[model samples]
Target chain A: MFARNRSGNSQVLSTMKAKQKRYEALIHAFHADIYRYAYWLVKDQSVAEDIVQETFLRAWRSLDALNDEQAAKSWLITILRRENARRFERKQLETVDIEDVQVHDDTQQADADVSDRELHRMLGGLSDEYREPLVLQLLFGFSGEEIATQLGLNKNTVMTRLFRARNQLRETLERQGENRGRANG
Target chain B: MDELEFRRRIYADPEATDKEVVAAAKADESKRKFWNEQLQFDKQLRKAAKVDVPDDLANRLIWQQSANEFARYQKRSRWYIALAASVAFTVGIGFTMWYHQPISIGGQALAHMQYAQIEESHSLLPVNLDMVNAKLASFGARFDEMIGDVEVVNFCHLSTVRSLHLIVDTPQGKMSVFIVPERNDIRVPSEFNDQQFHGESIKMQHANIMVVGSKEADLGEMKNIITQRIQFSA
Candidate 1:
């Protein structure tokens, strides 16, 4: 009986130790992904950094609650989304001027400026409600179910909004084409 | 075949899942063509939004984390000293009260002259044999009753705010010294030259008692016996 108890105790201790190591590795692996997601949602770099840091700090504190390694990404993202919401509860945020945000030219966007510039203008013209879900889905690559979970909406609602959001973009782009052609003619 | 479902699937990802492909397969040609165009647009949008993270950010975060850890370790060292003092005082109340001075304030070339004054003049010192033994052990030295001979003893304000009692054996009469680390703004008399303090200020140590002493009491010839014995690297 004594031998069995000793072995059981050692097994529990080792499992706890291994869990801690895995948690730390996951934190290092996904820190940037969490930061980028927060940045896209908030659109303010500093706030995004704070949100990501707080998310990871909360993850560290609550590591014991996590049971499966595969669930780490979603778990961290859930924390990030919560932190993002809590940001608005404490203080009224200043309305960001999306139009004034200057995009830095990078190697990725080195192609012709005309279409890309129009796309950026169109994206900025969107209301935050429309732009947010689109960014989460298209940019962050979140599934509809994951987006629904993050945004506190049903999966059906997420799909409907995404559907409408794309239609609006297509219509806006088509309208801009018509206006440009009329001007040239 | 609805216009809305077609656009959502295209915007979601170009290579839709089997469920999506089967749904699109059943759709009319016009709707299918719209999805194909929307899929192309979505690809362009994804490529456009994708950002290259600055390389310096990762390096900076690592450096910041390491520096934060180093700072916490330094703070923990001070806390440990305070904790050890509390435990030793609790364990040896009888011995510490009997023999220890309220504070001990003299030594060889370098002295740690704190304000040795007792609130009740009759109250015992906080140190005992074990406390002395601990210090001696840390320095790899055996505890001696006296500080191996001293020079000066005096009481001076540790800062403009607090008083310190000190003793030193300067060639000038074992000089009593009282050095204050707190009064940063006070002008000292011409007798004491103002030098940047490189010594540990006990006020900052989180100990119940504050230590006030000289900045460079240990240097040059003083280096021999006083190197590791004294605390405070800078």
Candidate 2:
């Protein structure tokens, strides 16, 4: 009986170690992308760091729930997004301009690459319906079906929003151009 | 697909490289043109979404995870066994939150000041004032005075005001300047110091310019010069 108990205890210890190993691997592999996604979600490094920390803590609890490595990025993203939403709920976050929150501060944009300025504004201006899918697609590289699953919406709705997001973005750019032209004229 | 359907599909996902979109694009001239234009737009969206990620994020996360695990293990095992561990974890987090509280204003610029060394960004892109002014103008904030050729300048948003963060190369070292729009909520201390930097918040008519420089930098002279130079172009 003692031998059996010893073996069982070691098994438990090994299982715990295995879980730790897996969690560490996940953290190392996906933490940056997770940070990037969180950065975009909250638009601040400190907040993004807080959310990423919480997301991983939660992920450590549910590591066994994730079986497919292929699904890991989306899984982490879903967790981060949910955590971000919960944070918003808890904080009752005010409407801080998200344009500043984009952690993806590419130097190229700072170059004032004029051709893309209007597009940048309209893209940032998109409502969550369009913006979420677009961000998922653009930043995280999630496909339509993956986004649908992550967001708990139908594939059709995700696609429509994705399409409409670009449409609205382009149409908004055109409207701005017209205004600019009128100002110039 | 017909023209309308093609437009809809391309409009929603301009960069869709799926087999169906590819085949459809190849089938017709107008569809091909639409696809190319959409791809070009995709390139721009890709660019605008560029961002900076904190370095050492993974290790920091692992350390955080280890701390929590240690805390949990203590709760499950001997209470005294993890006493030091749990207390350390709690204090560490509390201290960190005190360090990284998502403040109302100047929070992001503060982040740059603190972590630029860790992140190792040695140079800022060459941005003309007109371009910086245009971005600042988007939010109805402008600096009429010439603040000199700062390395980086962009209009950033705080919870309350549209702020501009500038990283200027100074004789002492680099300094981060946040021109934050004024609100009742923003109450940064007039003077503050950290281990590596000492700075002050200079209140302006329509905004507050909080500047942080290396410990050796003369923040007073910097503040006085900036105050004289900056006028909110009403």
Candidate 3:
């Protein structure tokens, strides 16, 4: 009778362990956002996918090091950026074509469809220096401080880049609008 | 505020307080409109980059984890089997050595000397003669010119117990015998076992022996010769 009770207790313990493992595997919940952040940073779907895949692989090995569930997205982004930088350090990647920088999406983003094209185009037109901070702050919704930490820049520098990026985009849009008016007038 | 300073504060943080943004906007009407447009653009950009992950990525990761576990299991199993096989092989060898043969003491030394003598003589008769000498040597007996057409010979020790051996011959059909010097009971009477000299036990002076050989052998004559040569006194 005691042996049966002990076995029953062990089975319960094992079930609990299994449930915890299932909960831990819930990293998939954030994959979409993480991919989006990586895609915004690199501006190439294939490279972004590579970065995401590498990030998740490393995350699987070091999942125990991750403390909070809420921090997982940011932690994954940090890993993606580091992996992308390491790739660059190892070998010079071919320059990505601006036209091909559109992120891959199977689902129709009904809300963002029209504005998303313009956003991608505007980002492509900007210099890499301004474009990176813009992507980090605006697209991924990172705070200026978070962007500053990720890019290894001072918060002041991040703020300056973000300001310049917006001003530059505004100026470019205005010029394009004026040109279109002349053609239509 | 100048157009530049007002634009700086607006774009520095997309989610900055409306009061701070409006303070800058109050200084410059055009700059305020520019901040509104930029904020809209930033929001659009954020919307564009929001990702939707595939449903299968989770299942793939789970499968990979299982594969890693299986690989670990196989590696551990191989080591367990190897450990068990090694232990079994050692145990098997130990059991085989235990029950097989009783070790004879002084047997190896006697065999070594016999091998040396056989190599030197190489003759069937002389080799048998050496065997007789070997047997006699155990009892501290000596002989000068004992002759026989000897055949089979063995001078191996029976453990540490006895070093006595045998030499057989076809002498006078079959008879070149000797006494053990230990038992002399047969010498007191004309007491003989069996017919003729085929199997004879005789006591001559100092010892007794039962011999087996050819029936044509002159046992009486051989006994008389041995009795004359042997000394019973000491």
Off by over 4 Å in 2: A1-17, A99-121, A177-185, B15-20, B78-234
Give all candidates' CA lDDT scores.
Answer: 0.55, 0.74, 0.60
lDDT of 3 by residue, A142-175 (tens): 7888888877899999899988887787787677
Location of the lowest summed lDDT over 10 successive residues in candidate 3 chain B: B184-193
**TM-score for chain A in each prediction:** 0.69, 0.72, 0.74
Summarize candidate 1's per-residue lDDT along A8-113 as a digit string, tens digits: 9999879867765765576667766667667666767677777876776676567777667547777887888888889889786774754565443222444333
The residue pairs in collision within model 3 are none
State the DockQ, from 0 to 1, for candidate 3: 0.36
Can you write out model 3's per-residue Cα lDDT over B86-130, one digit (the tens) per residue? 999988998877534444222232233333324232334545444
How do the candidates score on chain B by TM-score?
0.35, 0.47, 0.33
lDDT of 2 by residue, A31-94 (tens): 8767866766665678889999999999998899887876777778888888988997788766
Error of 3 at A79 (Å): 1.8
**Model 2 lDDT at residue B153:** 73
lDDT of 1: 0.55
| Best-to-worst ranking by DockQ | 3, 2, 1
What is the TM-score ranking, best to worst? 3, 2, 1
Best-fitting candidate, scored by DockQ: 3
Q: Give each prediction's DockQ, rounded to 2 decimals.
A: 0.13, 0.34, 0.36
Q: How many clashes does each candidate structure show, in the order listed?
A: 14, 7, 0
